[model samples]
Structure formats: structure tokens, C-alpha cells
Target: MAPNDFDNSIHDFDTTDDGSGPEPSPELWRHTPFTAFVAGEDTRAVYVRDHLPVLMPSFVVDFALRCTEFRSLPGHIARYAESQAWGSAEIEALRSWQRKLVRAGLFISRTELYTRAAAIRESNATPAKIGVIGFSTAGDRADLLLRALGSFAENVQTHGRAVDFLVADSAVDAGHRGRLRGLAGERAADLGVTLRYLGEQEKRLFATELIRRSQCRPEAVEFALFDPFGAGSAGGANRNALMLHEAGSVLAAVADDVLCELASTDSGDFKLALFSDTDPYDRWVFADRADALEAVSFEPRDYLAEQEKLLGRNLGDLLAGVPVNEVNVRKLGLTFLHLLDSGAARIRTTHLGHAGNPAIPTSSFYAPHKGTERELAAEAEIRYRASFASRGALARLATPSVGDGTVSPGMAIGLDHRELLPPFFPVLPAEDLVFGATMGACCPGALSGHLPLCLRHETNGDNAPLHPGEINRARQGSVFEFSQILRAIMAGHQPATQADTTARMQKLGRYICEFAAQPTLDFREALHRIVLTHESQKIMALEHALFTEIDAPEFWRRDIRDFLDHSRDRMQHEDFDIPYELKAGRTNEENRILMQKLIASYGRLLEDWPAIVAAAWDLRSEGKQFSASAKAD
Candidate 1:
């Protein structure tokens, strides 16, 4: 259709506004009839999936035609239309026509419009002086830009010298309106061009012009259907459906790019780290890997799911099958460690750890020379080293604790497990290969109160256990201890002496065996008892150590007394209860009895305190060291 024919039809649709001009209302630009029509639709699904496929070509054609009409309109007519007042009936008629067009599957939503406009703007071919005008003041400048660009694509495509404009009807305040007009006039003068403010009627003319122009060319609609963002596109489903379908491919490509980049940068020493969260014990291991990847890799997901099958499930389904007893938990933990050992060999890095930490045999299964301890430690060391050695690389296995049992192939720094280990295993090692610990109700980080601090951290002032607070304290303490051990190790240290190391190993073995012996129902209470006994023993030893090993300072005495007093208060409060409920066969009465015995034990320990301190002082002159002394030639 000729441009004049389109303009004539657009003028016919301007019947809504009365010829008598009125002052522009602030709300005039804010009220978009098309927006209201879209909002009133019953379902966006049909419009986005089905209707959009049929409407995009018409939309583009209409938009292009409107730009053409606006370009061709005389300056006087355009100014006259801008001044015309839009009456309520006229607004309603306009809204109805827009709504009908949308319902008939011939209208495009603002989102689609903006997406295309933005793509156009980003293209190098876009003109430098393209003008974008918005009628409403309610939306931000971005929204205005989208609307203007979408409405005048043809002008942007055809003219390289057209500047954008925004004649906001919401500039109702006379002073603001005056300032806007003045700015427009100054800009026009500067550019040696004319800037006319279009009214609601004039905007309607533009819309009608687009419709008339589009109706003349039926084939253009079909062409638009084939455009990716057009209504006629074959797979014009929902907005994101196409993108989602290609997500896997996109991810694969991204992964390939990352691997290529890594290989390019550090050719020989590049680490191909793999981790899995499917095995409960390796949750922290996986987390540590994640932390490492976050630092260097642009795409961490590439490494995250690499070993999903080895763990028998994806990370999302790791905890789906819960273990009912300590045996099952231990089995899972061992399995996780073994899997980690295997995965580490596949990677390029020569360092391998059980759970993202240095390879330390923490389980009692590898404690000292007690039966299979040495054998198992040797087998484990050989197994890990051979994996890397087969690939022409040497693997270094290191541990934070000496009690983990040393093998020739690995280094056992001989640190005390209690001093070096956290209460719960952390995903990342607090110290080089020492995983920090955390306390939670779940298996991976749960603190079974095997440690004295872990038990006390869970207890309240009344001796009743705090639900999560104590657990949180244990977790925090674990991290703190890990940091301390890490710092100590970095400063250069040796393992504990053989005698001290044996004693610690024996203690850990006993605790583990006793814990494993408890029935599921009695596990919690048993753990509590063990923790209490251990704490009492520690206090007794500390009393003796004060005189013999540590200097007896005033602050030390006060600190010891204060700690004992707090423990005594907690034990005395009968109302204090365990934070969690006992298992199916356990009872509160059984727990209560245990608490009574503990309280009595605490009382006895305090009564013997004076004698204990005196005995410790007597032994001070003996000057015996508990830990083995440094070896001298």
C-alpha cells in the first residue's frame, strides 16, 4: 500500500479524541491500551506458544509501516495531532481495538518487542542517530526505549540520521512540561531539525498506519514466520522453550571450551580434579573441589558431575536412602574414601586425598601396628600411589595425624588426632590434608559426641543439651582447631613421640569400638556417657599437668575453677534434658539415670580436686614429659 493510503486510514481511527484540545494529563502516557489488553488475557501460554508463531511477521510489518508513516507525515499535521485531547470513549475504543487484535493472535507483547529491539540495537549495523520516543512516564527509560525502537524499526533501518525522542504525557506539571519542550527545542536547534510532540490521537494514527501497511503485503507475514524471533518461526513455542531444549548442547560446548582453556594455559601440571557428592562421606570433598574450581574454572559443573555413576547416584539423590545404624554409616564413609582414591588417580594432579584433604587414614582400621593397622595402611598407600605411577606420575600422600599409621610411601607428620581434627569433617581441609569438622543432625557432618568439646558444646548451662546451638559450637570449634593445626604444621613440626602416639591411638580405638557396639536406640546416650567420662579424665589430667608440665599461673587456676563450676551447675539442674529424642527403644528415664551417674561422678571429681592439685604439685619436681622428647644424637 502507498504511504498516503496508510496515513488516511490511520486518520480515520482518530475519532476517539475530541478536536477541542485540552491540557495533557499526567496519566495520559501511563495508560497503554495494549498493555491493559495483554493483562486481561486469560492465559499467556496460548499467546506465547501458538499465537506468537502467527503474529510476529504482522508485528514486524506493522512496526515498519508505522515508522514509514511517521517519517512521511507533515510537521503541522503531526503537531496538530499531538495537541488533540483523548476523551474517555476514544480511550475505550482504542483499548477495545487493541484487545481484539491481541485475542485474534495478531498482537505482540512488550517482552518480545524489546528482545528484538535490543538485538537490533546491539548489531553494528544500527544507525548512530536513531530516535526512540515513549508516550508514558510510568515505565523507566529502558521500557520507553524498547517501545520506541519496536514501534519505529523501519526508521532505524532506513535512516541513519534520525535522533530518538520521548514526548512523555506524564510531564503534566507546567514547569516540567515547559522545561522538556525547551530541551527539545534546544536539541532540535542544535541538530538543525524539527521536534514535534505527538498526541494520543497521533499515536493512534501511527498504529492504524502500521495495520494498513501490513494488510497490503500478505507474503511478508509468511516470511516473518521463518525468522527465529518471528511469529512464523516453526518452533515458536514458549519464550524460553527453544533455549531450554538446547541447554544440554550449550553446557557441553561450554565444558569443552573450559577444558581447552585449562589445557592451553598450564600444559603439563594442569589438574583434572573430579569430585562426587553421591557418597555421603565425600560431601565435603566435593565442596572442597567446588571451592578449587570456583577459583580457576569458569564452569564448575563440568567437574561436579563427572563421577556421579561411581557413587551410584547423582549428588541430588545422595541422601535418598538413609542409613539406620552406625555400621551402615561407616560402610558408606569407607566407600566414599575408596571412590575418592580411585577418582584422584584419573586426574593429572599428583596429590591425592581421601576427602579433598591430604590422604590420612583416620579410621581406627589403620591405627598404629595393632594387628592389620600397619598392613592396611601399607596397602592403602600402595593402592593410591600405583594409580598415579601407572600414568607416569608420582603421588604424594600426607596426613595431619601420626596415629593414622605411617607407611614408607607416605608421610605421617605424627600430630595428635584430637588436637588436629575437627569434631566433624569439613568439605575442605582446615589444615593441608586435615578436613575441618562440622556438627549437624545429618550423617556427613554429624557430631556423635565422641570428643569432649563436641559433647560440651552441645550442652547448655543447665546440663540439658541445646538443639542446634551446641552442634553449631562443635562445628565452629572444629574449624578453629583445624586452623590452629594448619598454622602449626606450616611452621614445621614433627609427629608425636611413639609413646604419646600409641596412647592416643589406643584411646581412639577404644572409643570407636565402644561406639560401634552400642545399639541404635542407645547410641546417643552412650555417646553422651563416653564424652562425660573423657571430660572428667581430661580435667583430672589437667590438674596434674598444671604442676608437672604447665606452670601454675593465677589465671589458670581461675579458668579451671570457672569451667568446673559451669559443668557442676549444668549437672545439678535435673530439668536439663537431651536436645534430641532417643531412638525407638530408648527412654527418657534411661537417659535421666545416666545423667544422675554423670552428675555424681562430677561431684566426686570436684571433691578430689584439692588432693589432685597437691599430688600434681608433688610430681612437678620429677619433671617427666608426657609426650616423647625430641630425639638427640
Candidate 2:
């Protein structure tokens, strides 16, 4: 049966006022599990029904187990299969959007784009654009931007290259933006890397102005400042990366990932031949000492008090001139990043790497492997799932039939081109994947070159979500992870030109209208399956990324296994009964009612995507500092 054919209850929620016929009455809706999950979601805590483990089914084995046993799941698990299918409902609409890209002849060379645009590649050691995509709650992650800028200055000192740093914040916080800009100016000026800040409104105004100046009927632009997919989101933090791509430009998103530049070359003046590396790191063993120590929370100011809590021995000795083994340094790094006083930075933007506690509550469908060491290993897998997929994706870009896999405005990627690549919508956490995939689809061989350049940095483990030894069950769909399955599956059906892409989008709109109205539960169930499939494919992709395991240090290999083993005991503390006090929020009925409203809203958004993408692309295009932004009109 098609994925949509699964008989699911979460898909049955009514969007109508009467709640008549097959749809439940509003009064009856109050008691459903779907509503309870979303209405009651937050970063802190929620009760997990015993059978529905918090672990994501990212592995094929886990996903298979869930599908095999899905029919026998408890009512809450089955009902909650789609507490928020609305998110997927919106994302699924992008499939219809892809067919619109005209399958004109493919060009696997970046030079073709420059030739077609009548543009020349600017030769320079410095990147063309570097925008920092900072999405947070009231700019709580201002520190990350600060840290990234500091690194940029350091990078200049280290690599001896000029930088242009841009911060395009999606969160709605003006005062916060002002404060960051204030702190950034003097620091940014010294390097001569002009720093520009744009909040959502400013970005829109800039995009609108660009559109007005162009005088092209707004629909002609292929990029968006935000909401490229026409789904109701800025796409994700990676949207800025897409907007920054123009012709033969090399751009980067100043994110938390460490910069370990590797050797690269170019395919003539037009194509950039560089590598985008996602070098995975254990939170405790970061490549950089400062980041490593910060992860385990080493407070030198209050060293005496914090040491007894974590290392028992004074890390003062380690920080001092005292000598130590690599093992001790790793241990200190863990404590340095861990501060018992600070639990899960509460900033809630997720910054695209912090999972386990995503900013939004997503699908709760899970397999039966609740508390196994294998499940604990899965946490590490999901934490960096995109890196694996992105590594594997190089294969798609490197296909002999396809052009060199060169991505534009690539972050977590290094691109050689410096021209226009369409900006992506921040709808799903996988916006970066979308940005890369979309660029690849538009010009499969346009990439200057394909090389694996993984950046090594601490990931979710640095977020300090759990106590020293605790790894809680996590939500699969959230801020940091990409729906690689979505991108991977859609890869083959790529449209050639933006005009063809629009045509396909129109066809999808018609299908969505009918699909939403159909009594069949395919759309909701199909989306749900995609979520699981993403997890499954994620684990499978690790094979491509982990070929370097043979070179890992003995200590990292031995103790890392022990740490994961130790975490299993801590995670096995399962609880099905959430106390009334602990579960204080909307009642089940209230949550159900709210869910229906969201489902209906998402359905509408999905249907309206084509119009939304066209307008938003024109506007969102302004969010990046693309020199060609004016010409894009």
C-alpha cells in the first residue's frame, strides 16, 4: 500500500466548525492524545506513555520494528502518530513544487551558469558572502554570534583572509538585535569585515525594494528571503545560505561549527572546488580546547566549587602549566562544558544543532526499543544525522552523469561559485539540506568540485540538556535535523528550470486541494512515514561517513563506548505516569481542539505554497548580502 494508505487516527482530526460527519465534534475532540502533546509541549518535561519510547527510529532496524508493530500500538501511540502532522503537511507540499522546475538540459559545470548569466567569476582569496543565520528566542543566542565573530577575527589572524560577516536573524527581537550590533561593531571593524544586521522586517523591506527596482512581475524571481517552500516558516536557519549564492560566489553561514579549512582547488575561474566537512566530535573531546572546556562547564572564576561537583580534582591544574594526558584533557573538557547550575541553555532557538529538546514538539511516533544501549547510540546518530547524509549526498552530486556537486552559498559547505542560487524557506529543520539539494537540482554539475570537508565541533552534547550521566528520550523532528529522506527521495525528480519548477508547483497545489479533501488518510500517513524514513536513512548513511573509524584513537574508542554504555542505565528510568501537577497544561480535549486548528492551518498553508514561494522568494532574496540581489529582480 502507498504510505498514505495507512489507517491513522491523527489524520482524522476535523478542520470544520461543525465537526460533523466523520470528523469528531469539538466537545469530543477535547480528549484526544494529539492535542495533549502539542498544547503541553515545552523544553522542560512531558510524560511519555510507556510503550512509546522517546528514542527516534532513525535506523532501518528501529523503523522496521515500529512499522511491524505499529498495528499493535496502544491507543495513545496510534492516535499520536500525527499530533503535528501539520508540519509535515506543509513540507509535503514541496514535492508538488519541485515538478515545476523545467527539466531543461542539465549543466554539471558551474562555468555554464556564469556563461549563461554573462557574468565573470571574481577571483579572490576571501569568500564572496558570509551570513550568520541566528534563529533564537529573543536573541538568546547572541553569545553564539559573538563567539562566531570572534572566531572570524581569529580565522583572519590564522588564515590571513578578509571576511564579510552578516547576521540575518529570523526571531522577532529588535532590542536584542540592537544589543548584538552594538557589541559587534568595534570588534568587526578591526578585521575590515563589514558586519551587517537584518531582522526579519528589515530583510523583507530590502527584498521588497529589490523587487520594486527590478520591475519584473514579482513571480519571476527564483529566490525567497524566507518561506521559499511556501510552507509557513523561514524554511530554517540555512535559508540565508541559499540567498547568498549568486553566479560564482562562495558564501558561508557563520554557525557554531568549528572551522578547520582543508586544501581545495577550482575548475577554472567560474567554478569553486572546495570541501564542506562535518567532522563529528564528542561533546567532551572538541577539536578546540575552549569549546571542549565550555562543554563540560569549567568555571575558573568559581573553580573550587565546581571541581568537587564534576572532576573531583582541580581542573585548575590542567588549565595551569601542569602537564596531563590526553584522557584527562578530554575529561576536563566534559566538565568544562557542563555546569550543573545551567541546564539546557533555555534559549530555545535550537540554533540548528541542538536536538533531544527541539524548539517545537514534533511527531511522537516511536519504536519499542525504549532503553537499550543501541537506543543510546541512536541519540548520537540523530544528533549528527545530517552530516552523514550530507557526506553521502556528495555521491549524488558526484554522479558521473551529473556535474561536479558544487553547492552555492554553502554553510557546513564551502562553495566555489559566486552567483545567484535560490534561497530556501525555513519551514523544516532541514532547511540546509533543502538549500543544498535545491542548488544541486537546479545545476547538478554546476558545482566547481566535490570534496568532503567535515567541520569538527561539539553538537547536542554541548547543549547540556541532561545531567552528567543522563540522556533522556528525544523528539525526532526538531530544530537541528534535516529531513534528508525528503531531499534524497526528491533528488531524482529534480526540475530543470525555475519556470518548470513553478509549473510543477501549480500541479502540486491542485493535488493538495484534492488530497486534503479526500477521505483517504494518505497525506498524513505519508508524511508520518517520511519522518520515520528520515531516521532510517540517516542511520544508513553513516556507512559513508564513518570510513575513518579505523584511525580513531584508542582512548576515544574505549571510553566512548563506556560513556554510551553508562548512559543506558541513566536513560532506562522510564516513566509512564506524569503527575497531575507535572502535567499542568491544557486538558486532552483542549489540546485536541488546538491540534485541529493547526492541521487546518497547515493544510491551507500547503495548498497556498506556490503563491507564497513566489512572493517570499522575491522578499527573502533581500535577506542575504548578494551583490546580484538588485539584478535578481
TM-score versus the correct structure, for each prediction:
0.17, 0.41
lDDT string, candidate 1, 458-557, tens digits: 0011222111112333211110122222222212322222223223323332333344445645754554544455445545644564455343334334
What is the model-wide C-alpha lDDT for candidate 2? 0.31
Candidate with best lDDT: 2
Q: Please provide, for model 2 over 249-287, each residue's C-alpha lDDT reduced to its tens digit, 9 standing for 90 to 100.
A: 344443433332221111122111112222111111112
Residue 312 lDDT, candidate 1, scale 0-100: 18
Q: Could you tell me the C-alpha RMSD of candidate 2 in Å? A: 22.7
- lDDT for model 1, on a 0 to 1 scale? 0.24
Among the numbered candidates, top TM-score falls to 2
